[model samples]
Target: MYKLKTKETDNSVIEFIESVDSPKKREDAYQLLDIFTETTGYKAKMWGPSIIGFGAYHYKYDSGHEGDAPLVGFSPRKAKISLYFATGDTERENLLKDFGKHTTGKACVYINKVADIHTDVLQALINQSIRFLKETYPNH
Candidate 1:
C-alpha cells in the first residue's frame, strides 16, 4: 500500500535546493514544487538525493526490464532545471514552439528558469506526460 511521505529532518532534496547559493534558483525550486503538485494532483516527495518527485508507478517492459519510478519529477541542475516526463514527441510541438528556447533530451525537458516558459503550458505538458505514461503502461 502507498503511504504519504511526511516531512523529514534529513531532507536532502530540500537541503540541496537550499544549497544552490542562488536566490533565483531557490525560488524557482519552490515554484516548481507548487506547480508540479497543482498540475499532477499528487503530493511531492524527495527521491534519492536531489529530485522532487510526485506519485509513483510500476513498469515492466516487454524486454523484461521493470522497475518503479516517480510518476513525475525534476532536478534543479546548476545551469538549468530538468523536468522528467515519460516521453516526448511532435504532439507537444505547439507547446514547445513557445517554450522560451530550451532543449530536450530523451525524456527530460531542460529550461533555464520557470519564468522563461509559460506556466500554464508547462503544467499542460506535465499533465499530458503523466496521462501518456498511465495510458501506455496502465498496469503501472
Candidate 2:
C-alpha cells in the first residue's frame, strides 16, 4: 500500500504554504491555521506538504484499512481552500446550504477564496466540524 505524499513532514508543509505566490492566499491560510488551532485546541502541525492539520485520530473500517489522520484541518490548494471535516453522513447539509459561496466533496468543503464566503458562516462551520470530530473521534 502507498500513502499519499501530500503530507510528508512539518517543515515541508510550512514551506509549501509559505511559498504560495499570493499574499491574500497566504493570509487566508494563516487565518485558517489560527482558527483550526483555536477551535480544535491542538497545536497546528504540517500534515505533509500543504495541509495544516489539527488533532490526530485513528480510524479502522470494516474492510480493515486503518491509519491515523488529523481530526480536522484544511489545505490551501491552488484552485481553492479545502476545509476538512470528518463528517460525511448528513452532518452539515443545512449549514452547507447557506455557506455563503462554496462547494463540497465527500468530506471537504471548498472555497474559491476566503473573501468569497461569509466569515461568520465559516466560523460556525469550523466550530460545528470541530465538535463533530471530537464527538466522533473522542480518543483522538
Candidate 3:
C-alpha cells in the first residue's frame, strides 16, 4: 500500500507557524494563513507537518488510487514557499502569467515570499483551484 505522507492530522496550524526558524518565513506563513482562509472561506488545518490547508475534497483516480486532499494549501519551506493549487486548469496557468516572481510545478507554485507575488492573482488562483476540484470530484 502507498501511504500518503501528507495526510491530514490534528496538529495546530498556529503552533506550526510559530515554530518556523526563519523570521521572514514565519511572517509569510501568517500572511498565507490569512489569505488562504479569506479566499477559500474555510479555517486552516494542518496537513502533514508543514502544509496549512483549507477546504478538502476526496478523489479517486483511474488507477484505483483514492485519497482526500485540500482544495488549496501551502507550506513555508526553507528554500521557497510551496503553494498547492489545482492541476490541469487552464485558468490557473493564465493567471500565473502575471502572478509575479513565482515558479510552478505539476501542481505546486513556488514563491520566495508573500510580497513577491500579487495577492489578488493568488486569490484568483485559490478560487479557480477550488472550483476545478469541486467540479472534478463532485461527490466530494
Candidate 4:
C-alpha cells in the first residue's frame, strides 16, 4: 500500500513562509496567502512541509489510489513560486493564455513573483480548480 507523503499538518503556515530564504519570495508568499484566501474563501493550511494550501477534496483514481488534496495551493520555492491547480481542466489552459509571465508543469504554474502574473487570472484559476475538483469528486 502506497501512502501519501503530503498530508495536511498542524504546522504554522506563517512560520513556513517566514523561513523562506529569499526576502522577495517571502513577501510574494504573503501576497499569495492573501490572494488565495480571499479568492477561495478558505483559510490557508499547511500541506506537507512546504505547500501552503486552501480548501481540500478527496480523490480516488481508477487505479484505486485515493487521498485528500488541496483544491488549490502554492509553494514559494527557491527557483519560482509554484501555483497548484487541477490537472485536467481545459479552462485552466484557456485562462493561462492571459496569466502573464509564468510557466506550467502538469499541475503547477511557476512564476518568478506575484507581480509577474495577473492576480485576476490567478483567482480565476483558483476558482476553476475548486469547481472542477468538486464536480470530479462529488462524493468526497
The clash count for each model shown is 0, 2, 0, 0
Over 4 Å off, model 3: none
Model 4 lDDT tens row, 1-140: 99999989999999999999999999999999999999999999999999999999999989999999999999999999999999897999999999999998877899999998999999999999999999999986
Ranking by lDDT: 4, 3, 1, 2
Segments in model 4 whose C-alpha atoms lie over 4 Å from true places: none
In terms of lDDT, model 2 sits at 0.75
Give candidate 4's error at residue 126 in angstroms. 0.5
* lDDT digits (tens) for residues 12-40 of candidate 2: 55576789888888889988877677776
- How does model 1 score by TM-score? 0.83
Better of 1 and 3 by lDDT: 3
Could you tell me how far off, in angstroms, the CA of residue 116 lies in candidate 2 after the best superposition?
Answer: 1.6
Ranking of all candidate structures by their TM-score, best first: 4, 3, 2, 1
Q: Model 3, range 56-136, lDDT digits (tens) per residue? A: 999999999899989999999999999999898789889999899998887799999999999999999999999999999
Q: In model 2, which regions exceed 4 Å deviation?
A: 2-8, 12-14
